[model samples]
Target chain A: MTTPLMIEARGVEKWYPNGFQALRGADLSVHQGEVVVIMGPSGSGKSTFIRTFNGLEDFQKGSIVVDGITLSDDVRQIDAIRREVGMVFQQFNLFPHLTVLENVALAPVLVRRRPKAEVQQQALELLDRVGIQHQAHKYPGQLSGGQQQRVAIARSLCMEPRIMLFDEPTSALDPEMVQEVLAVMQELARDGMTMVVVSHEVRFARQVASRVALMADGQVVEVAPPEQFFTAPGHERSRQFLSQIG
Target chain B: MSASPNLSHPQRTASPPRLHRLRRELFASPLDGLITIALVASLAAAATGFLHWATTQARWAVIQANSNLFAIGRYPIEQQWRLWLLVTLLAAATGLSWGLLRAWPRADRRGSAWPPNDTIAAALLTAISFYVPLALHAQAGIQMRWWAITALLLLVRAAAGRWGPLVPRQLRPLLALLWPVLYLIGMVLISGGLGLMPVPPAEWGGLLLTLVEASFAILLCFPLGVLLALGRRSALPLLRWGSVVYIEFIRGAPLITLLFLGQNILGFLLPGGLAPDRVWRAAWVLTFFAAAYVAEAVRSGLAALPPGQLEAARSLGLNLPQSLMHVVLPQALRVALPATVGQFITLLQDTTLLSLIGLLDLLGVARTVMANPAFLGRNAEVYLVLAILFWCCCAALGLGSRALEHRLNPNTVALNTSAHKA
Candidate 1:
């Protein structure tokens, strides 16, 4: 690929204090505009691995470089990396006290020290893009689950992040509401936003992903295009996981 | 199971008659009937006896004669106008706050009705309860005229609620800024600072002293408590440990002992034996003591918040302070509001302990009045008045906190229920 690398991680390792190892030397690299989806069983550490990309989770030993800025123990570097990376969670954790527009506009105004009027205008545009412009003045609690998730997406997009991480973004949605969020993610992918998603939706992976990575026991065991990963299994664990889910 | 006809449309089933409901509740069985009758008889007897005593036996002469002492203990008579001016300022501020609050648009689209019936009723009830006794017993002269003027100012400002929206948007910020300025002005007027005749803290007493001490303590302790709460949760070990130690030490000691120590030992502990006034010492002690409790309250609030909220804020590039100030604390403080206000009320009541340390708060002045040979053996009247005053203040605080909680959480059931009704 001629595109520049957006994220690079080498030998990431994380261990909880209770002696449980969540991640053990996991490595993945994504070029700009590439969509990488990590699929695994519950304990395979897919969530933990992506969380480390934005410095949300601490790793015992690993080096991560995002958008040419290396993630280190330094607070300033962590903050800088966070500013460049945006994350969406399964629960759609919007600030319940603030209006939908305020939730999207808050970080830019507070963290970026941008003018309120400019940020709010941008926030409204993002909300419109997510198809919830009418619900902008309402609090998060007043919105439907799908609407709230879409607002969450708009909130992340307002930062104009170079890399977006999704940790089971649709896993918390109702079965009927999943497609609305998936549709938004698909749109994001088509727009050439670099994305890392951890989800169980094989259809999303098959449709939107540039490459699919399989995780097993705290490590990425296989990385391949969706057609190859789904139709022809390279690893025994991958074959077993597909059969179990099916 | 077959569906009953009433179950299919419960609302269509007419409620049982009130007489039948009453009978079912009070006389379902022989024993129930006897118990109800016995309880009713006892309640009636107690009520009648209290009414008889209140109407005929209780002498309010002591309260009537010492109203000035109760309002502003030992404040020189010449400076009494300053107290009246303070009252007028407070009345106007209260009205303006109420008007502005009502004028602010709610998120739920329900318009704030002007001259809200319940609020007006409450104000009238409070005025009647306090004013009736004073009118019947006390001489109606300068004090009464000042009271009328205070009430007039309050009415005028509250009427401004209807026009609060008409206030220019540019001037609204100034309106918000006016509060702290007014508070400072109040302090200066009370203490006679900035070219006015200075009044010593020793001369401050009665409800005036109690209120001054409580207000200052509440204002100062709230931020201190929030900081201490955050410090307790800090990743830095020193700050966490220091907060833990302070909270524990203060919570471990009794308030009375702290008050005594503040009055006696705090002077020696300060550099160059710089003893502040006794009132100042008492107020500081109350502030520090209440802050420990407030910290615990706020900590509970912080604990109730989901871990995801902080993570979301951080992922948006907010540093710890920005994340906390914008997202975490607003939600946590809302959760902590009831308990924090509870601490404030307790702190206000705790100021009564200042009397024990030689400062004459409301309780202290009451004791002084009871000891006067002219008002000998009027303990019931004196104590009753004091209890009523304290109750009024505490109840007002409770109401204010409830209003604040409603304002902060428009998503709460309180607003939802109103919306449902609408």
Candidate 2:
């Protein structure tokens, strides 16, 4: 079996308006159904790099392709790329104004213009799958952190995305809530969804990730399977990051 | 369940007698207590004097004689049905639409904390200024119009209860999407149209004129405000700068100055030989003024949102328009309600200034009411009635905003109910 590339981001460079270089020649490639964990200290451009995949963040110079389409300045192409990519934010930004079912159903009904009844039916099912069907009628504000994050995941999944990007999804969770979110991610990985996750959960990476890509100062410092990357790092930067976390 | 952030509020408890609590609160120290007693005595004396004068000396003849002018001000009596019908339709549509949308929105029901003390005091003072003389039943025609309004409100309540639940949740956004169209139809109905006689806006007067001007400006300016807010935050410098200039310029100038321009100067801008009607001019100015304010309110609401919301919407494949209409606007409006309501109430009061421009607004017509030979020297009574009218309208706005806020804040309602039960 041959692996197909799902994302190819090369020579990515980004600078803030104030001349702060957040990304300098960052590069990474993700294959279909592969779980890539990007582990980095804070401010290493982990979030920025993932954001560029869905056009949430723009790079000054880069050729980033996702799901066979290359990123461009064209609105249509950006929209096209977004349809195939689902992103879960650290803040679990489930729309507070909408109930869990509505939040999950919003994209499909509004963007896809699918019939509301069908999407909402599927939403409740998705909620059931995430073990939060009981909370489906409730608003995001009424839910606990773990439940909100789960609902956020269900909301993203309702769009039927081909690829998922998790920007430190569990970072904002309380200690007890972290595993509940990770368990959902693990189940998604087992279902063979192509995923790029920027997280510091070393144990999660070792348990489920196909590859571990360590980033520093907006560039990929090392990439290897979790076992080799964690136990036998080839780069000093990778070793230093691992040691700091350890 | 009591997750209220207000840790300062004591638990709801059975307190001591009201007089005892009042004494403790107002007169904690001996000197303070003495002063409080003296003030209470003087206030009671003044109240007794006021009650005597109000019950015996004050003549409500001015109110009784000019009730028609105060309510509609010579709106061709036959054509008055148009206003009544418009009122019913607008109320029904708003009630139905809002009820449908109430299925979502976790709004704060703990009451919208009014922003400043001055506004409350001012509103209360104006309300108090007129209610004493205004309560007397003056005319059957005015009472019937009011009855029709109450009937319309009850109809809305019944309709929303029966049909609102039947509207599919997915179709609710479609209702929102259709607002501009519904609003246009409602405007044409009131402003005259298709088969109806074209009642020149010039003929709209008194409290009817005031309410129409303020309500239309509010309804129309909201969409404009949303657009302006988006433009203010747009990536294009042209749009962003244009919005900034428009908002700042309109906000920087006083509302009356803008009204003056709308009344006199706007006619010059229109094509020669066909000056725009007075009502349209006033409305245009009021809409612009209110839009600028609504834009700023919406901007703050937009700003209060975390960047994650937009990002989340976009990442789900929802395009700019879809994201804005569904995700962004709903949340923004939730935060912006109080500010929007404040602008609306202020615009309502400012409409009285149209009287200064020779329009027969409530205040303007009240002056006409006083000029009548029988009502001469009854200036205090007429003005007091006018104040009561304006105050009632403003109070309705406050109550509506609170209801909308409560409907939106389901979590707060949940907490409130559960806490009470506990």
Q: How many angstroms is residue B284 displaced in model 1 relative to the true structure, after the best TM-score fit?
A: 0.5
Q: For residues B268-370, what per-residue lDDT tens digits would candidate 1 score against the true structure?
A: 7766523477888888888889999999999999999999999999999999999999999999999999999999999999988888888899999999999
Report, for every candidate in turn, its global Cα lDDT versus the true structure.
0.88, 0.82
Candidate 1, superposed: residue stretches over 4 Å from native: B1-33, B119-130, B133-136, B268-275, B413-422
Candidate 2 per-residue lDDT over residues B20-40, each given as its tens digit:
457557877889988989999
TM-scores, one per candidate: 0.94, 0.85
TM-score of 2: 0.85
Question: What's model 2's lDDT at B235?
Answer: 91
Worst 10 residues of 2 chain B by lDDT: B106-115
Predicted candidate 2 versus true structure: per-residue lDDT over A18-135, tens digit per residue: 9999999999999989999999989999999999998988888979998999898998999999988889999998888888888999999877889999999999999998889998
> Largest DockQ belongs to which candidate?
1
Candidate 1 Cα deviation (angstroms), residue A12: 0.5
